[model samples]
Target: MTEHSEHGTQFVSKKYTSWPAMTEDINGGTLHAAFILAPLAMVMAREGDVPVKIVHLGHRDGTAIVVRKDSPYESFADLRGTEMAIPHRYANQRILIEKLKEDFGFGDDEITLIDFNPPEMPAALEAGQFESYIVGEPFAAKAEVDGFGRVLYFTKDIWPKFISCVLIVTQELIDTDPELVAELVQGISASGKWLDEGDERLMAGVHREGHIPVDPGRGAQVIIPDGFGTSPRMQAAMIASQRQYYNQDPELLKWVLSRPPDRVRYTELALARDEMEEIQRYAERLGFFSRRPVTAEDPFGFDDYCDPSFAESGRRPLPLQPADGQ
Candidate 1:
């Protein structure tokens, strides 16, 4: 429960804290960077506040839209003008929410932003809390298994093929613990590789033993909700699919980079992962990489990492404007 101010950002050692502990302190590793160590981190930079030295855990498996099995509303189109349930304040939901507002002209005021949180979304939907719910994973699968409803549309259908949601730690940790950060990042990248190549039994073992509480086979990860691989191609497609959300022409991505409310780079990490080794080499080509002296030796080589001595400087949020003439 310690907080220090470093370099205009509230430097919290907690950002590097372990899983259960991180989540307990700040809404469950729901906001922790340690969980995700690589590639997925680049995708989350789509949002403005993400740190530059982020370690992505993985991508969202996909999204699912559903109504009560017997609800009068039967299709994704029915979501228009109908109240959709969601857990507000989750970083993962931000893009989806913005996309919904852009694609369907639905705004926060138009739909019910349920306070029940993600875990409760399916149950709330089944209980008639709303006409439909925006959900992910085992919860969605559980709804169908219980005969509550079926998938009306999915992220693959409405959004992009590959979407990344990241887990990030403060630069303080990267600066304070470079060696540790590298280990964590390597773990993540390796974990993804392992998940992709490992046998089903191993995957099942991983799912059962890892952070997520649900059984991957309980119609969760098994139903395609938990993706095991890090598909770089999917990232491009996701960004493309998301253009409509920002009112950017889909074709514009070819001629220009994405214009976002955030600068679309490392704003969240204290040290910026693109400054790391193999990751920087792979990511910088995509423009997510940085030109800083990146070395794999220690992620926390920076003197300012985790010191939090200057955080009270009151930094302003990054200014983000729609790319030239959206």
Candidate 2:
């Protein structure tokens, strides 16, 4: 291992660095990462920036609503008309909460959206503060194990389960460090594999010092894909639903896909019209829009969020990329 500063080290042979301590440099530097509320939101937000490879840690596979195992509402069907609470706005919890309502033909108006952060939802739910709120893995697992609530459903089952919690970079990083990026991709796969195998002791030494949220048992539930790459098949659905997110206006999926993963799958919306319609109407229920418009307010929404484009001759994927040894 090659040490950079006394604080950070570089696996120089791999062309990346192991961020010794999670610091401001990680988020503010090329090592920047985001805690995602919605996995698909990640898909929509990172649509256009390609040269930059993204890192999908495969942890944060998403969450679901769990009620006390003995609750009257046995399943999602029971959630109808029931006042359900969730943590904050525009997160996976909020998104999936509304999704359940919409799937049942109820819109945002039908159910209540409550706002609270972590520990609050679990702590409150255990005390019966609210019917149910969105919760993540381990905690979701822990809640069920602790006799808090029976799972309403695991949200990942609701969709294709796009990888969430991505590590992103600027196009400039990729332009100057394509080889470095490639090696980092390999290292991500390596770390993902290590995370999977549980080679490091559980809370013994370095792994515990590493700020890892997962235990050996829970690590199995966490996903660590080889790279930040996304399946093309998911792009269509990701783009369509993202357009309705109301965060930044929707962008043209094409403009975003102009430079995507060098290799990926593709599915056209015409075939997915029914599903798209359901999502659009779901958004409407949340007051996202009264109706789905044929075109978006920002037809070029994808390209609009660039810090500075390192436009290359070919595709540039900016999904997520972790540090070399991290």
Candidate 3:
């Protein structure tokens, strides 16, 4: 592994074109950790026996339901008899759609839901392959910015604090090197706080050199070596990097960021039992737990699969200075 940080731990970033490919690697132990879909993570741990634990969340409420700008679909009622694309059957976006159907007094058969790769959804929608698409950013943002689509609703408007993806680590890593896990959780928390701080910080992150000032008291610091969007050359590099890393478009990313502050959130990410239970309830109702039956009384073990200690530790205030003249 390449040494990417001052700390002894080496980091390797991998990209996957599809979730199943990524999940397969996680199951086979080729990948140690991932930011994975929440419902899929639960299914992996409980049903697929992947022996992983949900440590933290990636982001909240970054999803939307979009329809063609020229289309006459204004309400959920208008979606009847139309086809919609989703990232996957197990995605929370799909669950959100299901919840919409229920709340609107519509049956499952009223609207057709098809599984399509998120990167393809915008082009597919443009070509009239589907009436609408629901997905996480910046794919949904792409359609809107490209002028072919308009938002039907942002998920936050319906499900406050909606969780789509989570940070998951293998049981082996938790057992063998917990300090690393703690450090990772803290870093994620800090990064999320930085992102949610406001536009200035967000723009700095995008336009300036990437580095985390060493917490002198802590003895080691995390470093992002790439200087993205720092200049014309780096801006092009950043765009290419985002495309490779997330299949993301720069315009869409800017659009997502320029929206209301609450369009998507990164703070308040600590894993909560109530939230997990709510997700489980939805997953169960949607028949996502096919390998085994689950219920509120005897649900797939959230207590066993989720470890909030790392997030709890991450939230504790760091020391202001080095202790006793290290």
lDDT of 1 at 304: 21
Q: Model 2 segments beyond 4 Å from truth?
A: 1-31, 38-57, 60-62, 160-163, 170-184, 193-297, 301-326
Residue runs of model 3 more than 4 Å from their true location after superposition: 1-10, 198-244, 295-299, 315-326
Weakest ten-residue segment in model 1 by summed lDDT: 1-10
Which ranking of candidates, highest TM-score first?
3, 2, 1
- Please give the TM-score that candidate 2 achieves against the real structure: 0.49
For 1-326, candidate 2 gives per-residue lDDT tens digits of 11111222233221121122222333345443322333232333334223323332324334556687667987677766666666445344565665566677886566676766554566678887777776554344446555556666665466444222334444566667655544444444433333333232221111212344454321111122233222321222132223222122122222222222211112110112233334434433454322322246533222322221222222222222233323
User: What CA RMSD would you report for each candidate?
Assistant: 18.2, 14.6, 6.3
Candidate 2 lDDT: 0.40
Error of 2 at 236 (Å): 33
Highest TM-score model number:
3
- Higher-TM-score candidate among 1 and 2? 2
The residue-level lDDT of candidate 2 at 218 comes to: 18
Q: Write the per-residue lDDT of candidate 1 for residues 234-314, one digit (tens) a residue.
A: 222223334222222323322121222111121222333233333334343434324343346523222322222222222
Q: Which parts of model 1 are misplaced by more than 4 Å?
A: 1-53, 105-109, 161-164, 199-326
Q: How do the residues 1-326 of candidate 3 rate in per-residue lDDT, one tens digit apiece?
A: 11222344544457888999999998888887898899988888887646999999988998989999999998878998999999999988888888889899888699999999988999999999999999998788888888989999898999999999999999989998998888777766765665566222212122233333333223222222342233222232243345335445554564675565567788899998998988888888778887777867865667867998987774422221122221
